[model samples]
Target: MLTQTLPTWLPRLSFAPVNTAPRGDTLVVVFLRGAADVLNMVVPHGEDAYYQLRPSLGIARPDDSKTKKEERTVDLDGFFGLHPNMSPLLEAWQSEQLAIIHACGAPDESRSHFKAMELMERGVDDERGPASGWIGRHLATLNTGNSSPLRAVGMGTRPQRSLSGSVPVSALRSITDFHLGGDLRALQQMRAALETVYAGDILGQETLSIMDTLQKLDVQNYQSPITNYPDTEFGLALKQTAMLIKAEVGLEVSAIDLGGWDTHFAQGSSAGIMPNLMKDLAEGLAAFHADMADHQNQLTTVTMSEFGRRASENGSLGTDHGHGSMMMVSAAMWTAAKSTGSGLGWRKVNSLGQVIWRSQQIIVMCFPRF
Candidate 1:
């Protein structure tokens, strides 16, 4: 029952030479902890069926001039639009640096939060699958000369299941304190754990140097380019990720979580609870997008959740767990206009179970040859 609390940062620069892992863009994974009503985040205004199914929860169309800006969807591809609170991400979309993939599925069709999140993070469809996460497998299979302890980072009190595997991951509680002066005890403890891969002095020294590099950049006061990152926990996670990317500390991937997405009541169609969640998500991402302008070609940000909401709303004015969620990817490497996926067109099929499969591509694509 422990949790992470956040608004934090640091930065610099270094170009990776040839023959290193993650020659591709650094990956930042933003996971919505609870089952986010993705239908609201990525509005399907063009689909009349969507409106009829959740009339009370349906987002107003882009052309609803009478509606307040926060009451209408921001058109993305004419057919789909973003929730009003997600307006912050529009800039990335306008620049064609963002892609929207609709109707992704969960491994568990049963709609159990614990089950689906576990399977999704572990990158498996069932208990029979490997316990290690997809990112872990990626690191284990690809052996590039890069073995920095900071290679993989999970922002929280614990490393995400997706980060569990043969590879070592630093489950950081504070990005600002990821250095020797801050977590010496933890580092000393890690020394024993990583001694196999990192010779005693090597791990310590490498980590010291990385932190020193970060200290030199004064990451604690990093200046974002396009816009400032919000002072929220989610924003803090991203700011730290941005700092790491800018610092060039050999970071290939980082995972961040944003909770409170289970909107079973007062999910809000135009402005309220859920909209606020959208605001935080969109703002944090927008700020990161702005700060990452220079690193866009070498950075890919993706948002995901456990599952989607039911097409029908409950009497509580909220949504129940169903299936068929969606994911949004922001990257310069992304060229696809928008992924319609496979079964969403029918207006009912909950992806028939394709969420984990398709979303993995975005993650795998981050490592050039991995």
Candidate 2:
């Protein structure tokens, strides 16, 4: 068999070394690819305008007779209810770690996915802008002397554009698949060769540091012994992230993108595409939360989409892309007192009120209020 030698610039395990602190603070960014109907996900039942606008697909209020237990939106307070699809997340909200930001969207007016994604990833509103990613810039700011190996990670094969910068960062694929499962001598050779290849490249060096962190975790038997995560892509990805954190790799930030939110056809308000995806999202996130319960303060999860669907349903029994969507931030980092008032308690409202922030700015809400 022909053994393909991985590129010298590509990180293998063992090359870059990082002197990271034990797990401190963690931030998780979830990119819900395609526009999600924010109105449906975080229904403002208090708004008569919302019901009037979305006649067919409007989510029923928790007290409505038409609302089924599973189908009814979880009451955020009394004004808003989570879409039945996102019940799992609602549970987290009840626990005080999950928060929702309503009417949030890219600062730019354009609905173009390419443009929106770029703006979000860059964390900027420049129409003609710099190529560096927003998270990447954040990492650059954190590059203190010791440059920890596992300071940042993106949970996919390709690191999101946000984490692309001059700082060292990594993407975790599979915890098991990432390690070199071979002999000691071969691993040593691979490491020596990699050090030479990444000597000049900054990103390469950072990736090398990530690899070193993974190797150390593998040796520590840090796999989740408590929770049984589902066998799906998102679940596995989250599990891997939890493992990295549990291993005390000093992971500060991570990103994961879940596609299929562009519900053009059977978006399924009662029990369809949106709900199923939300279930997976909720379950996966819940599992991660449970697994890292002890490290709650060290982590935060944020979910966002390019935009929200129209206020009304379309002819296809679904929704079209529209202005303003919802963003959810896990409350893992906030205190109970802070989260209660600061969190967007999914309350019922009487009118389609003006969004609380600048239309051109991205909305970010910390869970648990603190």
> Candidate 1 regions off by >4 Å?
1-24, 181-201, 215-220, 339-370
TM-score per candidate, in order? 0.82, 0.78
Q: Which lDDT tens digits does candidate 2 get at residues 261-320?
A: 887787777777887787788788878877778888767788888776666667887877
Candidates' C-alpha lDDT: 0.73, 0.67
Give per-residue lDDT, candidate 1, residue 234. 84
Candidates in order: C-alpha RMSD to true structure: 7.0, 7.6
How does model 1 score by TM-score? Answer: 0.82
Give the per-residue Cα lDDT of candidate 2 at 248.
52
Evaluated at residue 74, the lDDT of candidate 2 is 75
